[model samples]
Target: MKISAELRAFSGRLGHDFARPELLQRALTHGSIASTTRPDNQRLEFLGDRVLGLTMAEALFSADRAASEGQLAPRYNALVKGETCAAVAREIGLGDVLKLGRSEMLSGGRRKEALLADALEAVIAAIYLDAGLEAARGVILKHWADRLKNVDSDSRDAKTVLQEWAQANGMTPPRYVQTARSGPDHAPEFEITVRLDDGREAIASGQGTKRSIEQAAAQALLDRIEGTT
Candidate 1:
């Protein structure tokens, strides 16, 4: 099968020359544009997620022999989270080669964090299938090297830390409310408020989906409370 020049370039960026190019093609296909002729990457994404988790776990365990599971769990989550995956996808310019449907393309699907993250996982699975687990591990470690090295800085999610703080202080879990939303249907800005039971609160605005925005808001609040901002 003849592959497009664009896909060839994408493979170059991905740092893996696929033996079965069709796997790469299927990995790049989105559900929005899937059909009998072209299947989507959902199954690949599922498999890739497990591959990513195992690779990250092994990396962390080997890198820090003295660290307890408590310390390592946060680092694992930080490395395998969708936000990190989306950031890696952007680093490799994965969005430029995505096969999105007309509606999705029109709605800026290429820039959507969730889509990019899922596609990146699918690509990982494709590499694993094409070669083996070692190939997938190589790609993941190459892309995530910096993050792995700096994993100790802020490994836990902000929300989890905040919840821990609240419980320690004999308070309820922090509550997050979507105070406002604006912009077009395709790209929206979210304003979220994170409130503590003690009347302390923080407000922040973020771009992308509501869930991510809420996390960002919680992080912002945590930063402020911890005097890290």
Candidate 2:
């Protein structure tokens, strides 16, 4: 089967020329616009998630022989998290070639964090299916080259650290309340206020999934509290 010129160029950007272009097509197709004839990338995403985990696990283990499982876990999470995947997706312009439905397009589905992340995983699965693990690993490492190189123990999620800080201080965990949601449905910007039981709070806003922006709020709050200490 034939793929579009746009996808063909995207193949170059992703550094994988498809032996089976249909897999690439399905990889970019979203559930919102899927049908009996054209399946979405959900299955591919599932497989790709595992593929990514295994690859990252191998890379991290091989890269550092002295690191413990506990040390490796956070770094692995840092690399495989949705935010990292979304960032890599943006770098390769995966969102630009997505096959979104009419409503999704209007709502800015292309830029949605979760959607972009899922599509990237599906594309990985496609590459794996087209060739093998080696191909998938090559693509992943190449796209995530800088991230993998720079990932360290300090790469732990900010949300986890913020909650830990609250517990350490004998205070209730920070509450993340969505104060305002604006923009279209698929790509809304959320304003989240992270408040401590003692009434200190920090507000932050960004476009993406609520959880991602909540991390931003948590980081902002952490910076504020820690800076004052």
Candidate 3:
């Protein structure tokens, strides 16, 4: 399989050359593509998810001397969250490098936040495999620096914040339910609703990314319940 010049140029810009360029190719491949033609990126996505977490944890530890796991976990979670990853993928033009099936391409898979985010993770995993942990760490730190920079005390996880808000006000913790799910098996969009004890509810739609959409739903609930826009 021929890797595009654009992808090569992009990887060069990322400052690391993949020894297994095929990993990069697999990273860019979505499940929507025909299996015989293009390999799916799911395995890489799984590996990348853990690689990103570990890399982010190391970065946070090195950057902040005083932060505990309590403080660091949320920041790490926020940094590697799907929305942030999708944003980074878009910033790096990963969608343009994606190999999609004709139908998925027409369905705008390139523009879907979930696909972009998953592909980004796959890329990170590929980087880790092709090069090493350090190479992947560099890529993550470079792309996620801004998000990581605000990783001090104020950086609370959405679920924690939501729960705290509910508890402080003498209310019960919020509950999450899958209100709806759409799309094919490989690429599904989820609609989650966050509900409080008194039946006050906030609904939000998101993609396959659990962490991101959960945070989004939590944010929506926080805003609505607190009446703070």
Candidate 4:
């Protein structure tokens, strides 16, 4: 099957020429635009998530022969997480080729983190199906080479790092409390305070989604904890 010039360009960007061009098309198609004749990427995304994890795990294991599983696990997670996949998708301009429904397009589905990440994973699965493990690994390693080089020893997010520290110390998980919220509905600023079981706490304020604000609070508390250690 012949694909559009845009998809042919996307195939170039993805660094994989398709033997089964339909696979590439399905990989770029979202559920919103799926029909009886056209399938979505959900199944592809599911398979691709495992493909990504395995590729990253192998890369991390090989890169650090002396590192423990604990160290490798977080680094592996940091590499394959939705945020990281979305970043890679953006880097490759995957959003420009995505096929979305009208509502999804209007809501900026192409720019949505979850959508981008899922689509990227789907694309990986498509590559694997079209070629083989080596081909998929080559693509993943090529795209993730820089991240592999620069990944932190403990690449987990601040919240996860803090939670694990608390657990290791036999303390309950850190809790985030929202003290205040300001600004209009569309754009709001939030103040969050993260408190540990030991009564130690730190405050932070940010403007974004609630999760980002909570992360800021957690990072503040982690900074304080690390400073004294």
Candidate 5:
């Protein structure tokens, strides 16, 4: 599909233009479909992930002069986390612009937070490739400045945040239950259902080692409750 119109308009909204829109396309393409067809977005994702980290670190440094490296790490993680990235992607209609295979499209890949996050990172990499690091930093600063201002750049991990929220509300500690486990034992994808004593449950699905799944589940629960409150 010819994506120039969409790319051009998106670039304009981003306050920059891409000399090569194909890079943008490759950045937004998900591996599910693009693995066999094209280079896919993974490489861009790798590059964009670093770009996002560096951009966020710079923002934190400029905004919080008193913060130490330890203090800034978690804050940086929160801003550039998958959920935050997905939110930004949604804000700019990245999901709609994404090119998916028939199967992925039918499966609602456009709405998946992980896919949205990955695509956003790819787009960042694309912008970086098209223009320069400064251009990409401008885009990040434009979209994410507000979040950077509001969230504590020195906050702890999501699990800690979730626990604190539960404690503050006088509720029992949050429980993470393994609702479904799929894929091979060597490479399992866990579907965790996090429940609060207050009769609320938020499910998070993640593919990883056991430890990572636990963290993903906790992060999912934290986001769900945070959104509600």
Candidate 6:
């Protein structure tokens, strides 16, 4: 089958020319558009998640000999999280080539974080199937080079750090409350508040799922407390 110019360009950006182009096609297909003939990327996404985790884990272990498992765990999580994957997808323009159903297209599915992240994982799996583990690792490291180098900055998520701080200080866990949600059903902005038992609190707004917004709010509070941002 002749690959489209767009898919060809995407393959270039992805740094892997698929021997089996159908894998790439399947990876780009979304559940919204899936049929018996066109399989969605869900299974690929599942496999890619594990592939990504293993790649990151090995990279982190090799990069930091002095760092203990305690330190490496969080860095691995930061690198493999959905948000990070979505950011990488955006960098590669993965969203532009996504094959979405009509409803998804109308609902701004191309820009959705979850969709972008999932597609990226599926693409990783596609590359793995087409090539090998080394190929998959090379692609992941190429895209995540900067993040891996600066992994110290994001070693722990804001929520995790905040919880650790609270526990250390003998306070209860932080509470996250969604104050408001606005926008169309397809896209929404969330206003969330993160409160500590000791009365310290912070409010922040983000565009995406409630969990992400809540995490952003917690991060905001942590930044304020730590005077980092």
Top TM-score prediction, candidate number: 6
List of clashing residue pairs for candidate 2: none
**Minimal lDDT window, size 10, model 3:** 149-158
Per-prediction TM-score to the true structure, in the order listed:
0.85, 0.86, 0.69, 0.77, 0.71, 0.87
Enumerate clash totals for all models, in the order shown.
Answer: 0, 0, 0, 0, 0, 0
Output the lDDT of residue 87, model 3.
87
Model 5 off-target regions past 4 Å? 1-3, 35-37, 153-172, 176-229
> lDDT tens string, model 6, 1-229?
7899999999999999989999999999999999999999999999999999999999999998999989998899889988999999999999999999999999999999999999999999999999999999999999999999999886667788889989998999999988988989879989999999989899989678888887788888887888943
Tens digits of per-residue lDDT for model 5, 1-229: 3657777787776676777878987987777677665778988998999999999988889988998888887888789888789888888888888879897887677877778898889889988999999999999999997898776732456667777889999998888888898865544678877788988877777664455566677777777776876
State how far residue 77 of model 2 sits from its true place (Å): 1.7
Ranking by TM-score: 6, 2, 1, 4, 5, 3
Clashing pairs in 5: none
State the TM-score for model 3.
0.69
lDDT of 5: 0.80
User: Tens-digit lDDT track for model 1 on 1-229?
Assistant: 7889999998998889988999999999999999999999999999999999999999999999999999999899889988899999999999998999999999889998889999999999999999999999999999999999999865867788889998998999999999998988778989999999988888888678777777787888788888943
Off by over 4 Å in 6: 163-175, 195-201
Model 3, position 52, has a per-residue lDDT of 90
Cα-based lDDT at residue 184, candidate 4: 62
Q: Which ten residues in a row have the lowest lDDT in candidate 2?
A: 148-157
For model 6 the local lDDT of residue 51 reads 96
Candidate 2 is scored at a TM of 0.86
- Give the whole-model CA lDDT for all candidates, comma-separated: 0.91, 0.91, 0.82, 0.89, 0.80, 0.92
lDDT of 6 at 173: 93
Q: Tens-digit lDDT track for model 4 on 1-229?
A: 9889999898888899999999999999999999999999999999999999999988888888999988888788879988789889999999999999998897777877779999999999999999999999999999998999989843758888889999999999998889999876545678998898899999988665678778778888888888999
Cα error, residue 15 of model 6, in Å, equals 1.7
Misplaced by over 4 Å in model 1 are 163-175, 184-187, 195-201, 225-229
Query: Quick one: best lDDT, which candidate?
Result: 6
